[model samples]
Target: MTQGGEAAQHARDEGDDGDDAPATLPELYAAHRLGLVRLALLLVDDLETAQDVVQDAFAGLHARSRRLLPDPDRALAYLRVSVVNASRSALRRRRTARGYVPPHEPPGDSPEARAVLAEEHREVLDAVRALAPRQREVLVLRYWSGLDEAGIAETLGISRGAVKSTASRALDAVEKALEAKR
Candidate 1:
């Protein structure tokens, strides 16, 4: 059979055409886009860049949806991985560009000043931003994204034990940072 025929047959076998059908990419986007953006924001610390990261992740998933169809969970996992990777790329680019750019004065209304986050919340975010990339990713995936250890491990391409330990250490660091601020 042709590949298209095979895919159709697989979809049928999985009962993917009914109400119990797995979500399409658009549906997944509608449901999880904001959460994915929040996940990226936790990594990148810029809302616009975070949105771009999530958009790029969805585009990447759309490009590869043929192989990822029939299982919404797999698509979601692919999206999570894509967002993480894209955020990492953005961070790398930002870091490299920083060396070439002149430092500028802060905006009159910076994000922290413009927003109304609680003191503790702002402190925690500052601490999270100070964490190593891997530790920050672990904390965001574990806490903000509400992923299980296995899910975070799969998203990060790490072991579940690593996810657990990284989350522990990240949380400890956050606590210490907050305490030090007191």
Candidate 2:
């Protein structure tokens, strides 16, 4: 069979890769986009920055889709790693920007929905910002990005035991901070 014929037969035999049916890059993006965005938001503590981070991740994923994973499950894993890296990059950039004039706050008194979202957004952002950098990164990768300890460790370049301990410590710290804030 020609290459095209083989690809067609494989596609048919695979039945769209079964439950893993993210047949195209766009399909993969659609399935995981919102969750990835939210994970990035929690990691970076800024929604606009989160969107940018997710965007960069998607771009990277698109470029490497063919070589990164033959199966959708693994592609999702690749996307998760991309998001984590992009979010960390955004955090570094924000650190550099901190030396400039104080960051501007969004104006208050918009529609009711906007007002409510703004309040909740600030609360979550504050809670995340209270975490130590390593703790925050571990927590976001494990819980927010839905990565297992091994995956988190691999992504963060730490050991699995370290990921577990740091995640436990991070959760304790976050709870304490929230409790104290009350």
Best by TM-score: 2
Lowest lDDT sum, 10 consecutive residues, model 2, at: 14-23
**What are the models' TM-scores?**
0.45, 0.45
lDDT of 1 by residue, 126-166 (tens): 99999999999999887899999999999999999898889
Q: List the global CA lDDT of all models.
A: 0.88, 0.83
Question: Per-residue alpha-carbon lDDT of model 2 for 41-81, expressed as tens digits?
Answer: 89999899888888888888778878764677777888789
Against the correct fold, how does model 1 do in TM-score? Answer: 0.45
Superposed model 1: Cα runs more than 4 Å off = 1-22, 101-182
What's the TM for model 2?
Answer: 0.45
